[model samples]
Target: MNAALPFRDLSPDAPRVRVTLDGAPLDLPDGANLAAALLAAGVGSFRATPVSGAPRGPFCMMGACFDCLIEVDGVTRQACMMQVGAGLTLSRPMGKVAE
Candidate 1:
């Protein structure tokens, strides 16, 4: 675990799989929650608010909050609802507007 990150992985021994975040390669625990893994890996911000451009990260950790929204393989999704999978390409969603 990175000492600088505020989050820690509960399953330190879990097998790691490679994935990309904003085109940067990262080796994260396989099948772990995407938001948690990213946080543990020192990713503090998941996206920016469409209008204000304020930083946003996982808040509720459940599907109810849209704060964890990210682009997975070109599709926008909630990071908290996803699992860490090998070769997944993730990025902040672009041009999104709040309803």
Candidate 2:
């Protein structure tokens, strides 16, 4: 994660970013990373490892790793790499990775 690039923290007056998670609408901060947005929505697991089937979430927010995979707009993608956009539908994968 690039801790140097400051991100605006959630506040009462902050404008809402409309997005969908698991078919439900979620209001998050504008320009938030997908991991942070999903975490705010109480989503625990974003993906599983291909070899171990281990659950993953936001690990290295800088996109160096694929630990934050999630389905967005019907395409599986790296959550950490995506900026929170309006009308995004996020979901977890159902298939398990090979061990």
Candidate 3:
């Protein structure tokens, strides 16, 4: 676990797998909550608001809040509701520009 991050992995010895975040490679604990893993790995912001472009990350952490929205395998998904898996390609969803 990285001490610099705000969150810590409870299972420090858990198995790790490779995943890509915004094209950057990251080795995260397999089967862990995607949001929690990203947070533990020092990911500060998950996405930007479509309207304001303000940064946002996990909030409710229970699939209620859409703050953790991210693009995974070409689909927009809530990071908090998904698990860390090998070969996952994650990226911040593109926000619509104000007209």
Clashes of each: 0, 0, 0
Query: Which stretches of candidate 1 lie above 4 Å from their native place?
Result: 1-3, 94-99
Q: Model 3 reaches what TM-score against the true structure?
A: 0.89
Residue 99, model 3, lDDT: 81
What tens-digit string does per-residue lDDT give for candidate 3 at 1-99?
235757877888999999998888999999999999999888878888878878888999999988899999999999999999999999986565778
Model 2 agreement with the true structure over 6-81: per-residue lDDT tens digits: 3435654657778777777778767777787666556667876666677777778888888888899999898888
Q: Give per-model TM-scores.
A: 0.87, 0.72, 0.89
Model 1 residue 44 CA deviation in Å: 0.9
User: What is residue 41's positional error in candidate 2, in angstroms?
Assistant: 3.2
TM for candidate 1 is 0.87
lDDT of 2: 0.73
Better of 2 and 3 by TM-score: 3
Preferred candidate (lDDT higher): 2 or 3: 3
State the local distance difference test value for candidate 3: 0.88
**The CA-based lDDT of model 1 is what?**
0.88
The top-ranked prediction according to TM-score is 3
